[model samples]
Target: MSSTLLFFIVLAAMALAYYIGRQRAIGVVGGVSQINRLHSLPSYYGYYAALLVGLPAMLLLLLWVGLQGQILTALTLAELPPEVTADLSEGQLSLLTSDIRNLASGNLMGRDPSPAVEAAAARFQQLQQIATLSLWALTGAVVLAGMAWAWQHTKPSFRARNRVESILMLVMILFSLIAILTTLGIVLSVLFESIRFFQMVPWTEFLFGTRWSPQIALRAEQVGASGAFGAIPLFTGTLLISFIAMLLAVPVGLLSAVYLAEYAPRKVRAWAKPVLEILAGIPTVVYGFFAALTVAPFFRDLGQSVGLDVASESALAAGLVMGIMIVPFVSSLSEDVINAVPQSLRDGSYALGATQSETIRRIIFPAALPGIVGGVLLAVSRAIGETMIVVMAAGLAANLTANPLASVTTVTVQIVTLLTGDQEFDSAKTLAAFALGLTLFVVTLVLNVIALHIVRKYREQYD
Candidate 1:
């Protein structure tokens, strides 16, 4: 049976077990009227039984699915002629295995298989069928045994609720461990690849050198193909665009938030907040198109009219559109933070002869400053990580210039470019993407840490 079908069958079995367990509990308590004699509720008993039946069977299914491919592959390879496998490298063997599997499934294999390969493919198919049947039988047996055991154990004094709660707690802990382990895995993978990249291109050159070209010539004798791994230009461009975005976003978003939270009428605030937040729901690609097609042209024309040179794909266009895109993020969070400031603070300020604007500027703003800063940090991170807008509007020339009207590229754009084509992972060009990813990850992590520290420190002061 297919995994999905087997999953549904297991669920049905669990449902049946739940019904049986609930009725058994009621019977043990001498009917519904005497149900109060039970240690736990009938629902708890049902849940306990369902979990006992489902969890063990699902775990067995998962373990079988995870190991079946390796086992089948090993068995199939054993059926292949020794002469065919003796001289094959790991990569070649993997490709041959793929071809065998494809042939077994009657799919296109890109090339005709030898007789030995065809024989192995047939064996593979037979083994796969056996594995599937065995998995189904074993899973069903496990489900039946677990349900029977749980039903026999269901009694008036059974601690079903405690057992269920303990299982739930373990599941929660397992989920948390999965998240932490996944993060650690990512960090280690990126770190290793980055180390390899640095070995090819010196760390000092990659970190501090000004140029950013990453193309390596296929032949050593190729002309004019010096691959520069300098990342300074990309860093400069990213910061410049992000700074421009923040300049446009911070004032406009914060002012709008303040107006909606404190000054605007109820009806206006109600309608305007949602309308402003709708911008966050719009996809970044749509914003990219707006930046490229609409904003870039308008800026180019205006710069031309003013007798100033503007590139067709300038950082200013991307930054402006990105700032607009991030406005909702800033506004929504800041509004909530501002509104959370105590009304008592405002009254105290008023009693001190402070006007409404003065109260907001001095008292409310300080109290809410931590959250506002956190929101701005989040917006800044959003702007930094944005790829579509940078790729579509800002030209991919990694020019190390401070002029926003000039073309530039970001770290994300370069990473995408480096990894887009079919390239060997061993090459510096491909490894550079991992290096850039690690740097970006570290930068964002630092920003988050700083934001959290500031929020907590100031929150404690206020509270």
Candidate 2:
């Protein structure tokens, strides 16, 4: 509810900002009729003002809302009996806060609500409502203040264009700051949880150990029991499956993309691109079922006929299905990047008596290498993060072997298994999900970086 209100508040502030900015620019230009004489267009001034007044306020609102919930939770906890707070872990505390919020909204269900808890919940609700109202009022007041200040400074002699440009520059800075902050936040969250996981299991074991067992017993007596924390098998399984998927997807997708971008007739390209994209439009879960029910069985029988041991649930089947699922990603993105390569490069190659294939391979693709690698890297990340296909068709056994006929498990599958069903929150099994998530994030990041580097290096050779 507060989020929804904050959105409207920012929108209203933006509207007011646009009006103020436009009025100021009009005054400087002598009137709306003189807009053509101004240093910048009237709309730019409005947009500049809208960005200026709304961005800072929106940032403030976001920061305030983030902190406010935590602050309210702490206060509510402090007011509660010591016994209630004593046994609560961080996860439980979060759950408690959610319950309080539910109770405050008169929607508490399951188990009779305690009187004291109910009272605290009601107060929290009242405080949230009051805070929301106050924030909206304060934001409106600030908008009005800014508008008045701009109006007073607006005159025929005033430099409204310069002011608007300055505001526009600041808005761009804010946007860049937002992107950086978001990336930083994701990395830090992963790093912190990975550190915690490492503390529980030796970093050496996680990095170098070959065995990948992570099951920990539920009781205190189970501490120091035999459970391997090695991640090698999981890593190997991920690599093998991802490799197979990529091998299947890349060549087909790239050729399709090239044909569409460079040679296909207009009607064919138009119909082909969207039809290819429809492959990506299908849900991954649907692909999972296709892998499990159809592809896996078909492969198992085929391998059996060849007198080879093919597991009913094999990485090959999952990888094949996953590859099909990723074809559209590679095709769509590669098409865009291929099309972006200057057509002059192709013309130059053709003038040298090079065939279309030779031109694409030697000139156009090299020029578009960075974007192509970017697309492939993105596809690889999607393959690595894929869960449903591996869960359904790839076996749960964490086999380190790379043979396509054998069963294998991926990191995402393990994470799902570890966290599924009723379980103790602090258990290493539950925390392993966060650890796996952190590892997955790092792998994807590295892939992206390497892809960018490869693309850059390759482009420089030809460009």
Candidate 3:
């Protein structure tokens, strides 16, 4: 249903409750015609009654509808024939339940159904209709009964507003608790998987091993194969790519942001800002292919022409393209933050005869550094977690070398290769992806914490 329609329904119900409550309160007062004799000034009692009736019913309806399909399917299975049940596996049974529900809802078209199945479908349809009707009636009855009870309890000394406020506070706390619990759940799940991976492969071996051969043959007659879970190479690759990307991105991005924020004409900025943001809107996969097809080969030929040995899939190609892709990331955020710095700081520097660049370096940049650093940290996290560009342009070989000309593999690339085209889930190979994930999470977490701390410290200086 549309929100407007739902809201109107609730408003109408509340209005009815308010009118009924006021009339009932006046009746309870008997011969007292004084307006000041009211228990809760009528409106508070109405709000309390509406909240008591509407909130619980709405909650129940939402919960029931959310779980209705699953509960009905479970109930239907209990009523199904034993022979039909035995013939279906768990997955197939779930599919059958879905089909039956579809048939019950009159959504399935053009089927010549057997009498037995049709009868069952008809019975299910009846049950669903009855359940929906009963819920609506129950909601209305409960709302009316709550209104009547609250009206009867109305006394000159009643504290209905305080009661309603307490309930609202409880609801707010519940919402906050749910948000915190969800974040905790995600952290715990990652921790559990990391623990499982560590149990399968020793923490020391996984962390320090240099070779990453994650193959495990399933057959008994398979030839000798080694699987190593060394993460050092992946970490090295991540750093190399991030370093190269930062080299290309930071100077160009920061310069552009400074130009836009400080020196651009108003008319020019109006057009240029959107164009810069549009760069960010382009998909990363497009950049990946661009790096693979155009940049890598161009760099390879360029290196060969200069008598340098550069791999076709070198870190420079991936990093350069990835850097171009991330330029907008730095520029957009930095531009906003630089603009947000108080103009008084710039005016003060100008009063002392400081040039534009000097003012920016001394006052504006320092003031905006927190926001800029946050943007850079976010971009770094993106570069670290990037998978597609590295997968295509960077080679799969886990070279521990940091030379930009040499090919290297990254942590994200290894995780992708490990999980894709899977054989057995229980093997060390699959579990190793979790270990890599945990490592990635921890590294990103530390980077964020340090960035935020530095930003906070710098902010205090300016303030």
Give model 2's TM-score versus the native structure. 0.82
Off by over 4 Å in 2: 1-6, 9-13, 24-53, 56-60, 71-99, 218-225, 304-307, 336-378, 419-442, 460-463
Q: What digit string (tens of lDDT, one per residue) describes model 2 on residues 1-463?
A: 5677767967987897787778778877778798777766666667666766676677767777778877777777788878776878988888778889888877846878777778789779777887777777776676666666655655554555677678768769988998999999988876776777777888788877898777766577786656787888999999999999999999989989989998999999879888889999898899999999999999989988999899999999999999999999899988898887777788888999999889888888878878888889989999999999999999899998989889999999998998889866566666677788888988888988888887677654544
Error of 3 at 170 (Å): 3.2
Clashes of 1: 0
Q: How high is the lDDT of residue 192 in model 2?
A: 79
Off by over 4 Å in 3: 1-54, 86-168, 297-314, 395-399, 405-407, 420-425
Cα deviation at 303, candidate 2, in Å, is 3.7
User: Judged by lDDT, which candidate is best?
Assistant: 1
Compare the candidates by TM-score and give the number of the best one. 1
For residues 1-463, write the lDDT of model 1, one tens digit per residue: 6988999999999999899899999999899999999999998899999998999998998899899899999989987889999999999999999988899889977777899999999999999999999999999899989888888999999998999999999989999999999999999999999999999999899889999888888898997667889999999999999999999999999999999998999999989999999999999999999999999999999999999999999999999999999999999989999998888888889999999899899998999999999989988888899999999999899999999999999999999999897889998989999999999999998898888888887875665
Worst 10 residues of 2 by lDDT: 150-159
RMSD of every candidate to native, in Å, equals 2.1, 4.0, 5.1
Candidate 3 structure quality by residue, lDDT tens digits, 1-463: 3334444565677777776666665566663376467656667766777777667666756675677666666666677677766878877877667667778877864666555556667767776766666666766676677766777677666777787789889989999999999988877886887788888788998888887777776677776656777888899999999999988888888999999999999999999989988878888889889999999999999999999999999999999998998899999989988988887788999999999989989989889988899889988988999899998999899998989988998999988888888346577888788788889989999888887887777765654
Model 2, residue pairs in steric clash: none
Q: Whose lDDT is higher: candidate 2's or candidate 3's?
A: 2
Comparing 2 with 3 on TM-score, the higher-scoring candidate is 2
Worst 10 residues of 1 by lDDT: 454-463
* Candidate 1, residue 3: how far the Cα is off, in Å: 1.2
Candidate-wise lDDT, in order: 0.93, 0.82, 0.81
Candidate 1: which stretches are off by over 4 Å? 109-113, 350-354
